[model samples]
Target: MGRFEGKVCIVTGGASGIGAKTAEMFVEQGGCVVVTDVNDAAGEKLVGDIGASKAAYLHLDVTDPDACQAGVDLAVEKFGSVDYLLNSAVKMAPGMLKDLSLADWNTMVNIGLTGSFLMTQAVGNWLIENERPGSVVMMSSIGGRQPYGMSGAYSTVKAAVKMLADHFGIEWGGYNIRVNSIVAGHIETPLTAYLKDPEIKRGRSEVTPLGRVGQPVDIANAVLFLFSDEADYVTATALNVDGGITRSVMNHMPGRKWS
Candidate 1:
């Protein structure tokens, strides 16, 4: 039997990138999933690929609290009950703080940080009301724990997600709910496809003790573990799935010499 056999899951941003891969993994593992995103075309196509009987698509805007709650309701409505929630939707606007507009800052904060909280709050509430114990896997970043220039808003909001995960992990312990974040490094997802230079991307990878950049599946594997019954005792932590990228902050200086 698959790890997620007889499970029900909701995957936000399931249209593409890491979210898409995670949704695929869940379904492949025998989980029935509701794949949600604002990208109607892509989301529907993914549902089709996963098989409508095994998966369904929903249009979602995670930043909206009502919408967030509604998405959870829909998941339970469709699949009986939600056993796992994966908050993977994000907006990464690259810019410096001084150069960024208030709009840009709010956009990142709302979409990345606030959105995760709302989803957790909404879903956690549902689980509580139904007396169901569930697991949540939030998508955090190496940027959240580390400081990087030219990644102003993205970095700031990611950091906020880490804290949110900690807070939810503690507060929801009574509910038998596990909340955690994945501090992912340079994963080759469509989201980071814009960084096309080999030198630029390779430099990020070379510092990793693993000697490679992360793949979406790497992050998905971590998510699978956190959501599984095997990790019933684990909660409220930001696990680094960065191929050891965060192992040495000092690697930065030495890595610069290679440039």
Candidate 2:
């Protein structure tokens, strides 16, 4: 039997990129998935491709608290219960701290941080009321840990997300709820599609210990492990799925091979 044979997962931002890949993985592993995203066309197409038995699409704006709760309601109404939540919705607004506007910062935080919190709360509450064990996986970025001058708002919100996972994990442990964050590295997704340039791609690969950028499947696989019973004991941890880019700082020195 598949690892997630009897599971039901709610995946935010499931229209594309890592979220889409993760939702696909969940269904492949025998789970029913409620795929939520702002992109109705892509989301609906994904549900059609995955089949109605295994997947359903919901038009969700994660920043809206009511919408987040409604997503949980939809999942329960269709799939019976919510077993997992993948909070992957994000808004990437890259800007240096000095020039970053308050509006951009708020937008980023509202989507990335507050949106995640709302979803988590909604799902967490459902699990608690149902007396079920569950897991939550948040999508964070390498920028959250390292100082990325060009991604001030993104980095700030991601960092907060990491801590938010820790806080939720601690508070929800008594209820058998696991919360964790995935610190993604340079992955080739819609979000990072611009890095397709040879120079940029090569530069990224040179710095990563794995010698290449990550694919959506890589992050999806990691999330699957966390969602399954295999990670029953894991919680409040930030797993880095970034090809060791975060640890290869020395490789970027002026005369180093990577440089």
Candidate 3:
């Protein structure tokens, strides 16, 4: 049997990028998935592509409490239980803080940070009510632990997401629920279109200790591990799946080589 033959997962932002890949992986491993996203077309397409029997789509804006609960309700309705959640919904507004508009600031914070919080609570509540064990992986960024340039509210929201995971992990541990943050690196997603520039991509790849940037599948693999029974003892943790970029500070120096 596949690793998750009898499991069900809910993936926010499941239309594209890391979320899409994660949803596909879950279904491939024999888990049913509730794929939620504001992108109705893409969401429906994903559900179809993954096979309707194992995947279902919902138009979700994770910032709304009702919407978040609806996602949880959908999972249980379609699949029997809500065994996992990946909070990958995010909309970035990049600009210097001094020039950041209030609308942009709120959008970044609400969708990225509050969205995760609402989904976590909704799913966690359902698990508690049913006396079930579950796992949640919040999508944080490498920027969370350090500065990421020209991302006014994005970095701040990412930082808060990590702490949010930590807080929930502690409060929900007794219920056999695990909450953890996955700090993303320079992933080549639509959100990182700038990486399309060969010069920019090359620069990023060179700096990464692994000598390459990350792909959606790379993150999906780590996420699956966290959601699997293998990680039963893991909680209240932040797993950096960034190709060792965050801790390669010494490699940042010009002409530096740790090889």
Candidate 4:
């Protein structure tokens, strides 16, 4: 049997990019997935592609607590129980701190950080009530640790997501619920589709020790491991699946400034 056989997973932001890829992987591994996203058309398309027997699409606005709760409820109703949750929805508006508007800042934090919290709470409570164990994987970024210029809001919320994982990991460990964050580097997803130019892609790849931009599958594999029983001992940690980009800070600097 596949690794995720008989598992039920809820993937937020499942219409495209990493979320979509991860949902597909889960279904491939025999998991029943609830794909939630605001993009109803894409979400439904994905569910159809995966086959209705293995997947279902739900319209979810992560920023809304009611929607978040409804998504968890749907998963339980459809699949009997939720075994995993992948919080991958995010809203990024690049702007310098001084120029960033208050509305933009709130929007970023509400969707990225607050939305994650709401989803975690909903699933976590269900697991606790049912006396079942579950795993949660939140998508974070290298920007969380190494801030990026013109992305102050995104970076701040990502950093908070790491801490949020830690808090949940500790608070829910006694109940056998694992919580962790994946700190991705420069991944080539729809979220970063703006960097489609060859030069931009090459520049990002060259800076990484691996000499290539990361693919959604790279992050998806990591998520699978974290959710699998193999990682039963791992929790409250940030796994960097960044092609060594985060470690090669000096390589990223122009002309080796310090040296």
Candidate 5:
């Protein structure tokens, strides 16, 4: 039961969704988790619910390098070392290039892309300074590898994060640190709960070979493996957690109806 016994982890955006699920798994595996999010209320509540002994919520804005460093420092102070870093904080704005505002684009890039870089740099520095081998799991999206027209900013930023991981893997491999990414598909999370349209949901399911949506735990399970010794040699790879949907093409039949 204690796969991560005595390990410490830092999960950005750990207030909910995949981050929360991952933190829960880490705690269950005997890893102490530092849960940080801009959402102080939810973050505190989540930490409280997860139990103070296993998790602590820290107020953090990943875009702020100082805050990111502080979060990492807190993790080390509390748990001796930070063995895992999961960059899962993100914001999605759906709009075509023409329709999207520059401000919106900047926010997406800053939070999704720059934030990841900052967190990695800060936490990575800590791990290196302390001479501790660690693993980093970036929560990228399948949309990063494909075109989701209205999601230009998010797509661009995610793709950038993926590349960042690869670069980190190469640069830090000498220190025994591993960096990898997960390209997740349509997982049923509070972030996507707004996709209330039944038709959209059906289409999402139909496109996936598994004929269903993914749960947060599905992604968490993969993150656990990546951070564990099982994946000690795995790095610089974007593992897809999309229910085999990435291989299938959507049917584009006009006026076609299926009962």
Candidate 6:
């Protein structure tokens, strides 16, 4: 049997990037999943590709508390109890703080930090009330480890996401609800594709000790470990899946420009 056989999970931002890849992998591993995103088209297509038997698409705006609950509800209704939550919804508006707008800041804070909290709460509560154990993985960023210019409030929000995971781990461990955060390196995802000018990619690669950047699969593997029983004893921690890039921050994201 596959690792996630007979399990169910909710993947936010599941229409694209790391979220999309992770959802696909979940279904491949025999996990039923509710894949949620505001992009209904992509979300539907993803479920269609994964087949409706093992997956469902949800129109979720993670920043909305009701919408977050709706995703958990959909998972239970479509499959069964949700066994895992991958809070991957986030917005990255690249700009200096001086050039940042209120909208940019709020969007980042709402989607990345607040949204994570909402989803984790919904899942954690359900797991607790149902008397089941589960896991939650929040998608943090290497930016949270070090301040980076021209990344809007990304660093700030991701740092908060880590803290949220830490807090949940402490508060919910007694209930057997494990919580952890993943700090990803420069991943080559659809969301980061625009930042992939050859020079910038090279800079990221050089800074990474692995002499390469990360991919969605890298983060997905880490997330799955956290979700599985193998990590039953691992909780309340931040896992850096950054190719050792965090040993030193990139001097600057070169070739970054204002739109």
How accurate locally, in lDDT, is each candidate?
Answer: 0.88, 0.93, 0.94, 0.93, 0.90, 0.91
lDDT of 6 by residue, 89-127 (tens): 877877999989999898899888889989899999999
Model 6 misses residue 88 by how many Å?
0.4
TM-score of each: 0.94, 0.96, 0.97, 0.96, 0.94, 0.94
Please, what are the lDDT tens digits per residue for candidate 4 over residues 77-188? 9988899999999888789999999999999999999999999999999999999999999999999988888985999999999999999999999999999999999889
Cα-lDDT of candidate 2: 0.93
Root-mean-square deviation per candidate:
2.6, 1.9, 1.3, 1.8, 2.6, 5.1
Model 4, residue 198: C-alpha shift (Å): 0.3
Model 3 lDDT per residue over 99-214, tens place: 99999999999999999999999999999999999999999999998988899898899999999999999999999999999999999998999999999999999999999999
| Candidate 2 residue-wise lDDT, 1-259, digit = tens | 7788878999999999999999998988889999999999999999999999989999999999999999999999998999999999987777888998989898899989999999999999999999999999999899899777888588888899999999999999999999999999999988898788989999888889999999999999999988888899999999999999888877667763732
As for candidate 2, its clashing pairs are none
RMSD of 3: 1.3
| Number of the predicted model whose lDDT against the real structure is largest | 3
C-alpha-based local distance difference test score of model 6: 0.91
Better of 1 and 3 by TM-score: 3
What's the CA error at residue 63 for candidate 5, in Å?
Answer: 0.4
Runs in model 2 deviating more than 4 A are 255-259
Stretches off by above 4 angstroms in model 3 are 254-259
- 1-259 in candidate 5: lDDT tens per residue? 6999999999999998999999988998889999999899989998998899889999989889999999988998888888899999988777999889999998899899899999999888988998989999998888888877888598888888899999999999999999999999899888898556788788888878899888999999999999999999999989999998777764444676686
What shift in Å separates residue 185 of candidate 6 from its native position after superposition?
0.4
Model 6 is weakest, by summed lDDT over 10 consecutive residues, at 248-257
Candidate 4: segments with Cα more than 4 A from true spot:
252-259
Candidate 5 shows a clash count of: 0
Task: Name the regions of candidate 5 deviating beyond 4 angstroms.
Answer: 250-259
